[model samples]
Target: GPPRGRELEVARLVRQLARERIHNVVFTAADVHYAAAHYYDPTRAQFRDFEPFWEFVAGPIHAGTSAPLPMDNTFGPQVVFSKGAPPGQTLSPLAGLQFFGQLDVDSRSRTLTVQLKDASGQAIYRHTLQARRA
Candidate 1:
């Protein structure tokens, strides 16, 4: 996601989803060689009806990890959490800082837990989202 790369397209799609009463949406992605959590709050935006959702960035797996990507403010994105290479580390996929993300869902509780971890599966960050059934 290039900040606001496809602003109009994303906005249009989100609006459609909201119109269908689908509010529990979370956009999970990878390939940016970093990990971060973002929240898109509709209250701060022009489109007031869109439901708030999260966009989770995870992975590169064995590839080198880099710094976190910048957020696009078109959707009023807020950085909830972010983790990247240690201070002074260079940005490269071959930096031996491979990472990955996992999601654990508990249907009974209606909760989704996201974890960002290193090669050893040691979690670097964790977030839990509670879903509201329509």
Candidate 2:
């Protein structure tokens, strides 16, 4: 679901349901090279939220996908789980991680755990936050 593309339709559907059911969805490495997306749920009468998946195939190359360190980076909010964004900027670095890892969603509690890791599957950091109601 490349934020606005028809990429990985099946995976997008699975991730979409995970968000709706309030379950924990892991950032599994699918077939996509690098993928991110903004999901618009028709049921909620508005765009629900976004879920970004990092494949780890080329994670250590981009700034958004780079390893997050306490000193060598500027940390910000997890943008992959947002509903939508400003006009013409759905694919910005602020929208999704340029690197990759896993996105965990708790539908019952509306919680999301963003786990970032290096290319070798080493844990780097996590950002947990409550999801906004639609």
CA-lDDT, candidates in order: 0.77, 0.41
Error of 1 at 111 (Å): 0.9
Write out the backbone clash pairs for model 2: 3-36, 3-37, 22-107, 27-102, 64-98, 64-99, 65-98, 65-99
- lDDT string, candidate 2, 25-113, tens digits: 33344233233322223232222243422222224234332222221111112324322224333344554544456777788888876
Off by over 4 Å in 2: 1-58, 61-99
Quick one: best lDDT, which candidate? 1
**lDDT tens readout by residue for model 1, 8-110:** 6788888889999996799998857777888888876655557899988876765666677565556778888777786555456555567778999999999
Residue pairs whose backbone atoms clash in candidate 1? 64-93
Stretches off by above 4 angstroms in model 1 are 1-5, 46-49, 86-89, 92-94
Error of 2 at 73 (Å): 16
- Alpha-carbon shift of residue 14 in model 1 (angstroms): 0.6
